[model samples]
Target chain A: MLHTYLLSIQDQDPTKPLESFGEKLSYGGQMLLLGMATVFAVLCILWACLVIFKMLFHDLPAKKTKTADTVEQTVTEPVVEQTDDGEIIAAIAAAIAMAESECEHVKFRVVSFRRK
Target chain B: MLDAIKNFLGTTGVAQLFADSNWWQYLVMYVIVGVLFYLAIVKKYEPLLLMPIAFGMLLANLPGADLIHLDFFFDDYYISVEGGKIVGTLANDFTQFLQAIPNALYSITDSSIVFDFSEATLASAGTTMDAVNATFQEFLGNAATLTDGALHIKMSHVIKEVINNGGLVDILYLGVKLGVYPSLIFLGVGAMTDFTPLIANPKSLLMGAGAQLGVFAAFFFALFLGFSPMEAGAIGIIGGADGPTAILVTKELAPHLLGAIAIAAYSYMALIPIIQPPFMRLLTTEKERKIKMTNLRTVSKVEKVVFPIIVTAIVCLVIPAAAPLVGFLMLGNLFNVSGVSDRLSKTAQNELINIVTIFLGVSVGATANAENFLKPQTLYIIALGLCAFIISTCGGLITGKIMCKLSGGKINPLIGSAGVSAVPMAARVAQDEGRKADPSNFLLMHAMGPNVAGVIGSAVAAGVFLSFFA
Candidate 1:
């Protein structure tokens, strides 16, 4: 349909002068010119699409990000001594150190109490 | 010494100083330039351009000022260095060089060296700047920017060479050559127009056609008043108020009458509301003026897209001469209607229209040089243009009354006046007047049918003129 319409337009008023090879033409010539114009127009659209996509995806990410509330709570809230795997391991190590320190203190305290 | 100074102050005294030379002629020119500046600044008529043009005219007229004509110095090449040292002679004779250089060798040296003349074609194609370098070499013969360095062109030598080769030097100052810039302007015009309005309201095509009543009416009036057919046609188009169309028609039909026709058209177009309303009101009564119109039916997207294509085929087939104006208008409208390309349409309506309006305004204004414009016939053209506009308004309003009667008062007679194709201006006037009668009445959309119709009516009228007279 488009091709037929364009052909009909070109066919209208074919009184073009022989000398008017490159002379000023009417609207009919302009319509035919747009057929060729579409090619460059498409190329321009493609270029614009690439630029927009690059802007969307390829730029550097933000330097500072706001942590989600859940993650923030996990990191900031102090763990109870027996809270999780890391806390439990630290608790165990602390208990062992306390036992060793208390061994000397306990013997001395007992001796003192007995002597008293 | 005192007598010489006194005589210098007097009229015959100044004439005696130049030995019967016309010195007052120089003073008169300065006076004219001064008046132009005064009018530009005080009246604020086209201040943006007229001020600069007037200043340029003054500076150019100053004895030994030699600034604007510095370009003329480039017309003839002179050897110059950074420190004003003379160098080898330069040549600006592009055509002569082309003639001398064998086409075969020249093509090898630079296949692009030959003038294409198609850059102009491309510029019209809306492909601006691709061929600027080629344009500089071939058409202008002037180098690109002066940053390219001090250029030399041997004008005297080129003239001698041309004479030796039996060519004319008048061809060198082809700066003001005929047919080049005007056509390029037409190209720019073609690139910038949208034809969708005429397409959307195909019935409004008659409005444009109807508006050209003024063109033909003015033509016959001018002819009856002893102007030639060409002059008559040129004057008649002034009512159309289309600058490029006026330029194209005049350039073809009556190149000499371009100055008057252009001034009358632009001036009247600017004064559309003031010039057209009285005529509209005078022809119709207050009751007819206050008639309300219904809202325009919503146009479909498909219909909008199809409009430009269909109108172009139908209108151009019928009247080939109107193809340019109608084509551009429809094209501009097409851009507007094409939902996929809002950017292009916005550019056409905003940037392209703005830029072209400025150029079209000033260039046409400048063409109204003193000698061409200061004539009894120019006054006649202006008066006839007014009559044409009034008659067209009457034609539209009376036709609108007929439509109103035919459509059983459904059609507003006021909108008939807008059929003069001042676009939304006349339509807005109708809407304004309708609102005055009844506050809730909104006639703007209704008025647009005929408003857009007026543009087509005028183009069809121009085509009719072209068919019969051009």
Candidate 2:
């Protein structure tokens, strides 16, 4: 009776293996690394496509010779200056002023030189 | 004693100072000191910055010394006290000063609004009765004290509370931390930029795009090096070589990396004159460098206004992460183009930019605490950052070469390296280097297109990284 009760009470199953929680955690980690690697691979592909586009379209032949016409249309009066320094400075100042007029944030004044 | 003598000399002046030190350590120290002295005295690569950075390197490398301690600002605390009782507080004097200055500036703006006294307050407080009482007291031989009859609470306190609660520091931080100010700085940048040369040649924009290849390349490299996507993204933005853009991207992705990335970006920028010229000259022959660009065409004012809005809509829609930066930049540009809100534009340009700059510089500098900075990883990051810049420059130049070949020698590959968005500096370098190769070559006008385009490209790259990572 005792031997029969012991055999019945043990209820041991030899077919199934015990699984630890660490194995589960490692499985999650592996999945995460895989996901990241996949994302990086995709980005790299997109980057390659961009590089191809830049290379292909960078230099198309210039057909129209509109340089002279554009030059004539946009030409403005050149200012007279007293000296070489004045002319160079005035040109820079005018250029800066034009840039500022367009962009509006840059204020460049000639701090040292007095304008006549 | 002899060994000690050797140690001192080996550590600083001579090899004997490092007699007890390992051979490699002595070599590194000597090389660092020598390079520092050269840069400080000769190259003058930001004497203020390099000087401190060099000194920091020296201080850090010194054995058994805490002089390079990073705890000076971190360990201290500042708190406001009224009548020996603690009231308001901050962690550092910098934050306290940052708070105080803004409040002081605001109160002083319309001095009358804050200071003007009303007769009603005096009347309500019975000031006239108090004066009459004072006369009666004088007659009775005891002077009346003006304390009890009339009392007034200054509105300055109210303003202080409002400004403090509204957080002048936070708003100031918006400019510094969030890069709101630097975005506005684009206005000044815009005003200063000469797109005519670029407009005369739009091909330069391709060079600009080429330069941005470094930013994207850095992202991929960082990923391979085991940085998390977010960190890799933040680190890669350094390739942009634009401080504001770096700050903007880092603030969103990895705020912790802000200080390192900002320092790296700015340091590389200032070092461009030194770092880039050698490479440019090395990569190209004298003939290649001397490729003269055609004269640039005049850009219409209408085109300028449309450019910003179009860029904003397209970029923001495509990369929503870059909206804050690209939005503010275009808005600032719009102000300049519209010419309607001159005052608002001026304020954005000067006062706003200035206020933001000081705060941004100091706060970003302060973020470099010893704990965050003294890691082996930081060394790697700095090295990677330098490599990224060099690689990007090479990438752009190489791409430019391909384009030049494709274009049948019409395009100057030199300007393509300026694509890194160091702005006018990079463009100017290309121009200067081009002239050195051939005095008549004018690449500045052509380089501007790519230089400006590099800005947009870096921002877009940053946007792309942020979108995927953040």
Most DockQ-accurate candidate: 2
Cα lDDT listed for each candidate: 0.51, 0.57
- Scored against the true structure, residue B92 in model 1 reaches a CA lDDT of 37
- Score every model by TM-score: 0.53, 0.56
Q: What is the DockQ score, from 0 to 1, of model 2?
A: 0.02
Q: After superposition, how far is residue B217 of candidate 1 from its true place, in Å?
A: 0.9
For candidate 2, state the interface root-mean-square deviation in angstroms to 1 decimal: 13.9
Name the candidate that leads on TM-score: 2
Model 2 over residues B1-470: C-alpha lDDT tens digits? 99998776766634433455454554565475467557756776545444544454454444444332222221111223334333332224323332432222212232111211245654654444444344434432121122332222222332333344433323344444435656766555553444434434555555656666566566555655556556766787788887788887787676667667777787788788777888888777777897765554444454555556766776777668777666776777677776787787777767876655666664565454444655665676787688778877876787688878899887788987888888767877887787677765656656666787677667776676666555
Native-structure RMSD, model 1: 25.0
Interface RMSD, every prediction, one decimal place = 26.1, 13.9
User: What are the root-mean-square deviations of the candidates from the true structure over C-alphas?
Assistant: 25.0, 20.3
